[model samples]
Target chain A: MPCKFCSEKPVIQLPNSERKLCKSCFIKYFERKAIRTINKYKLIEENDHVVIAVSGGKDSLSLLHLLKKYCQKRNNKIKLSVLQIDEGIKDYRDISIEDTKKFCKSFGIKLHIASYEKETGKTLDKIKKQHKKTIACSMCGVLRRYLLNKYSRKLKATKLATGHNLDDEAQSIIMNQFRHNIALSARLGPITGVKKDPRFIPRIKPFYFLTEKEVATYAYLHNLISKFNECPYCEESNRFFIRDMLNDVEAKYPGTKHSIVASFIEVLPLLKKKYKNQEINSCRLCKEPTSSEICSACKVKEKIKS
Target chain B: MPKIYLEKEDKILEVKELLVSDILKSLKINPTTVLITKNNELILDDVKLSKEDRISIIPVISGG
Candidate 1:
C-alpha cells in the first residue's frame, strides 16, 4: 500500500488506524505526535534543562534523536543532556553502550554514565549470582530508577525524559491491574508521580502514544542503534509476560494498547487526585523521595550486602 | 523459498513463500512485537514473500 499522505511505498501501518506511512511521512508523523504529547502535557518548558535517560536501545536512541531534532527547531532555552545507567550486565550493556557513545558523539551531546557497581558496590551480575531468589528486573528497576532520578537531580535537570512508549505504558497498566497495585498505577503516565517533591526530578515520556514498532522502525531507518539486543534477564520479569499478552491482544484487536492508554489518560487525573494526598517521605538510607522510610534501591543494596 | 533471519536468535530459516503475516504466524512471533525487512528495507505486513527475498525479522521489545 502507498503512504496515506504520499505516493511512496508505505513503511509502517499505524497500530491504531489503517493508515500506512512511508519513511519520510512516518518520521514527520512520529515527531509531531511526540511534540503534541509534550505540548499537551507541558513536559518541556523554556529554560528547562532536560536530561534524557537513555538505555542505548531503540526506544531511547530514537527519543534522544527526536529531542535533538525538536530542540533544533524550537527555542534555544531548553538544555539537553544524556544519562545512561550501566546495570553492569556482561556482553549486553557493554555492546549497547558503544552504540550510545557513537550516537552521542555524532549528535554532539555529552553522555553521563552511572553504574550499579560504582554506587552500590556490586554489579547486577554479581548481585544476581548471590541473590538467586530475587528477580533481576525487580532489583535492576529499582536501582536504575534511583540512579536516573538521583543523577538527573545532580545534573540540575528540570525534567528527565525517558523512551517509554504506548506499548510499555499499556503493559504497566495491565501489570498493575493484575497485581492489584493502584498506587503504582497512579505513578504511571506521560509525566510520572502523583505530586512533585523537591528532590524528585520529573520524568517525561515524549513517545508516550507511539507504538514500539513505530519507534523501532524510526530507529532502523535512521540507524540510530547499531543492533537490536534483548536483555539476557528479560524473560524472568513479569513484564515480559505482560508484553507478550498485550502484543497478542493488539494483534487480534488493533489499537488495544492505544485504547488502554487513552482510557487510562482519561482517568489519570482522578488517580492522581486520589493518591496525591498520600505523603511522600525521604528514604532514611538514601534520602531519596519514597512512600516508605527506606527506598527500594537501598533495600536491594541491603539484600546484596547480606 | 524465502530466507528469514531472526534477529534475536541470530538464526536464519528457509521457508515457503508466504505473506508477511503468515511468516510471523508460523514463527509464533506477534506482528506487534517485530518489524519485517526485505533487503534491509522495511516492508508492510501485507507484502508477499518471493523466492529471492532476504527478510529479517527485527524484535522491537527491549526490557530494562
Candidate 2:
C-alpha cells in the first residue's frame, strides 16, 4: 500500500537494502512503539478522556498518528481532542496550528484551538508588556501548560498526552543534574505524579522510549509536518546550552543519559519516602495541590488582568 | 571575548563580556521567560556576564 500519511507513491524501497523498515514501515514502527508504551503502561483507563497537546511538531504529530492507530486497532471509541495553543508569535504558531488542524481533520479527531490572546484575554505580547524583565518565551511555556490544564480539566479530560520523546526526557535529566535539582529530575519520566484529584489530570508521555531521530524520521516520511524550525525567541534558553553540552556527552557516554534518569526513577520510591514529607494539600487560594499557597498556574493567571 | 564555558560539552564557547539581556538576545532567548543557571545558580537575565561563568538554560521542562 502507498504510505498512509502523504499519499506518497510507495515506501517499499529502502535506501539501504539491509534496512528493516521501508520508509513506511519505518514510520509505522515509531507510532506502533508509542502505542505499545501507552497500552503497556495502562495509561488510558476506561472512562478516561484525553487531551493531546498538539504542537504541530514532529514528535507530537507522530504521537497523534499513533494514538489514532491504536484507537482504530482496539476499536475503542475513546474521546480524544487535540488542543492547539497558539502562542500569538506571528507566523510561528500560526503555521503550526494550521498543520495540527489539517492532521486532526484528516483523522477526524475533534480539535480545539486557543490563542494566547483569545483564551487569556491577553496576548503573549501583552504578557511581555507587563513583565519587561522576563522573556516572552518563558511566559509562553508557562501559559501553555497552565491553559492546557485549565482547558483540559474544564473539558473533563482524565489525562493529558504530550509529544515529549526520549531525547527530551534524557536532556531534562542531564540538565536537572547539571543544575543540582534532583527532586525535580526524579519526576521527569513516563508518568509524572498521580495526584488523583478531580481537578488534576495526570500527563503521560507515550514517546518515552523513542529517540529524537526516530521521531523526526517518522514525521519526514509522513510528510508536510509544518516546517517551523526552532523559535527565533527561545535560542537563548539555557536548556539549549545544556542541550549543546549534553550532545557529545550523551553520544560518548552511551547510556549515561538514560542511566541518570533511570537512577532517579530507581531511587524514587526511597526519595519520596525520605523527602516527600506532607500529604499533598490544596493551594491556599485555588485548592490545587501545591507546595505553596497557590498553584503555579493560578499564580501566573493572577498576572493576567481580568 | 569572555570565556563562558558550557562544560557539559567540555568545550568553551567565546561569549562576549555582555549583559544577560544582550546574551539572551544573541542566543535568541527571551529572558525571565526561561531558567538560566550560571555557576550552578539560577541567574537572572539581567545579571552581567563575565569570562569565568558556566551557564545552562532549562526552560520549565514539561514532557512526559
Candidate 3:
C-alpha cells in the first residue's frame, strides 16, 4: 500500500488513525504531532529553560532527541538541559547513567545528575533494605519526582519535560481510578500540577499523545542508545498489572488507549476546576510546596533515618 | 522473500509476505515487546509486508 499523504511506499499503519505513511512522512508526522501537542497545551514559551528528565531509557532519550530536533527545526529559542537521577541501584542505574552521559555529550546538552546517596544519604538499595514492607518502585518514584522538581527549581527552569507517553498516562489514569484516588486523577494530564508556583516547575510531556510502541520505534529508527534492561528491584506493582491489562485491551480493541487519554483530557478541566482551591503550603523541612507542614520526601527520610 | 532484521541480535530472517503479527508469531516473539520497522520506518501489526521490504525488529520494554 502507498502512503496516505504522499505517493511514496507506505511503511507504517497507525493503529488509531489507520493512516499509512512512508519513512520521511512518518517522521514528519510524529514530530508534528508532538509539536502540536506542545503548542495546543502551551507547554513551553519563548526563552523558556526546559529541563528534561532523562533516564537513558527509550522514552526519555526519545524526548530529549525530539525536543532538540524540534527546537533546531523551528528555531525555537528555548534552552534544553538534562536531569538524571541516580537511584544508586548497583548495576541498573550505573549503566544507564553512562548511556545518559554519552547521549548528552553527543547532543551537546548539559546534564545534571543527582544521586540519592548525596541528597538523602540513603540510596534506593538501602531504603529497600530497611523498609522491606515498602515497594522499591514506590520509594524510587517519590525520590525521583522530588529530586527532579527540586533540581529543576534550583536551576531556575521555567518548565520540566518528562518522557511520559500515552501508555503511561492512560495507565496512570486507570490506576488512579482503580485506587479510587480522585484527587490524584485530577493531577494527570500532558502538563502536570494544578496549582503552579514559582518554586515548583511544571512538567510537560511531549510524547503525551504518542504510545510506547511509537516512541520506541522512533528511538530505534533514530539509532538512539537506550538501555532496555528492567530494574532488578522493580516489583510487579499495580501499575504493572494496569499496563498489561491496558495493553491487552488495546490489542483487542484498537484505539482504546487513545480513547482513554481523550476522555481524561476532556474531563481534566473539570477535575482541575474542582481541585483548584486545594490549599498548598511550604514544607517545614525542605521549604518545597506541599499541602502539609512536612512533605512526603521528608517523611520518607525520617523513616530511613529512624 | 522479505527479510526481517533483528537489530539487537544482528540476525536476519527471510520469510514470505506476512502480516507483522504473523511474522512475530512465527518468530515466537511477543507482539507487545518489540517494534517492527520496514525500510527504517515503523510498521503496525496489521500492515502487510512484501518480499522486497527490508524490516527490522527491535526489542523494547516499558519503564517510567
Candidate 4:
C-alpha cells in the first residue's frame, strides 16, 4: 500500500489510527504525534529544564531524540539533560551504559549516572543475594524512582521525562485495576497526578500516546544505537505477564491498548477528584514525599543494611 | 539470498525469499519479542522478502 501522506510505499499501519505510512513519513508522523501530546498536556513550557530518565533502551533513546528534535524545530528554550541509574546488574546495565554514553555524546546532552550502590550502599546484585525474599524489580523500581527524582531536582530540572509509551501506560492501568489500587491508578497520566510539591519534580511522558511497536520502529528507523538486553533481574516480575497478555490482545485487536488508555483518560478527572484530598507525608529519614513516615526506598535501604 | 542481521547476536544469516514471519519461524525466533527491519525500515509479519533485501531482527527491551 502507498503511504497515505506520500507517494512512497507504506511500511507500517498505526494501530489506533490505522494510517499507513512509509519510512520517512512514519518517522515524521511519530514525532508530530509526540509533539501534539506534549502540547495537549502542556508537558513543557518556556525555559523549562527537562531531565530525561534514559535506560539506554529503545524507548528512551527514541524519546531523547524526539524531544531534541522538538526543541530544535520549535526553538523552545528548554535545556535537556539525561539521568541514568545504574542498577548494578552484571552484564546488563554495564553494556547499556556504553550505549547511553555514546548517544548522549552524539546528541551533545549532559548525562548524570547514579548508582544504587552510591545511593543506598548496595548494588542490585548484592541486594538480591542478601534479600532473597524481596522481589528484584520491586526493589530496583523504588530505588530507581527515588534516585531519578532526587537527581533531577539536584540538576535543577523543572520536569522529569520518561519514555513510557502507550503500551506501558495501558498495562499499568490494567495492572492497577487488577490489583484494585485506584489511588495508584489516579497517579497515571501524561503528567503525574500527584499534588505539586517542591521536593517532587513532576514526571512527564512525551510518548504517552505512541505504542511500544511505534517507539521501537521509530528507534530502528532513526538508526539509534540502543541496548535490547533484558535486565537479568526482571524476568520474575508480574509486569512481564501483563505485557505479554496485552500484546496478545493488541495483536488480535490492534487498538485495544489505545482504548485502555483512552478509557483511563475519560475517567481521570473523576479519579483525580476522588483522590484530591489524599494526604502526602514526608519520609522521616529522607524527607522525601511519601504516604508514610518512611518511604519505600528508605525501608528497602534498612532491609539491605540489616 | 537475503541477509538477516540479527541485532541481538550481532550475526547475519542468509535465507531465501519468504514472509517475514516464516523467516523468523525458520530461525526459531519469537516474532513478539523482536522486531524485523529491512534496509532500516520496519517490516510487518506478512510482508514478503526479496533476495535483494537486507533485514535486521532487533530485540524489544524496555523497563517497567
**Predicted model with the maximum lDDT:** 1
Q: How displaced is residue A244 in candidate 1, in Å?
A: 0.5
lDDT of candidate 3 over A1-306, digit per residue (tens)? 678988787656676666887778878888989999999999988899999999989899999999998888768699999999999888888888999898999999999999999988888888778778877777678788899999998898999999999989999999888888989988879899888778679999989999887787777778874535778765547687788788778777888989999999999999999999988899999888887899888887887885
Taking the tens digit of each residue's C-alpha lDDT, what string does model 4 give over A131-162? 88888887777898899999999999999999
lDDT of 3: 0.83
Off by over 4 Å in 4: B1-17, B21-33, B50-54
> What 10-residue stretch in candidate 2 chain A is worst by lDDT?
A11-20
**Per-residue lDDT of model 1, residues A1-306, tens digit only:** 799998899999988788999999999998899999999999999889999999999899999999998888876568999999999999999888888888899999999999999998988889888888888997888989999999999999999999999989999999999999989999989999899887889999999999898888899999864666778887789898888888888888887888899999999999999999998898998788889999988888888996
Considering only N, C-alpha and C atoms within 3 Å, which residue pairs clash in candidate 3?
A: none
Name the 10 consecutive residues with the lowest summed lDDT in model 1 chain B: B55-64
**DockQ, 0 to 1 scale, candidate 3:** 0.35
Inter-residue clash pairs, candidate 4:
none
- Per-model TM against the reference: 0.97, 0.71, 0.88, 0.91
lDDT of 4 at A202: 92
| lDDT agreement with native, every candidate | 0.89, 0.64, 0.83, 0.85
Q: What is the TM-score of chain A alone in each candidate?
A: 0.98, 0.82, 0.95, 0.96
Residue-level error in angstroms, candidate 2, position A106:
1.4
Give the chain B TM-score for each candidate: 0.90, 0.64, 0.85, 0.87
| Order of quality (DockQ) | 1, 4, 3, 2
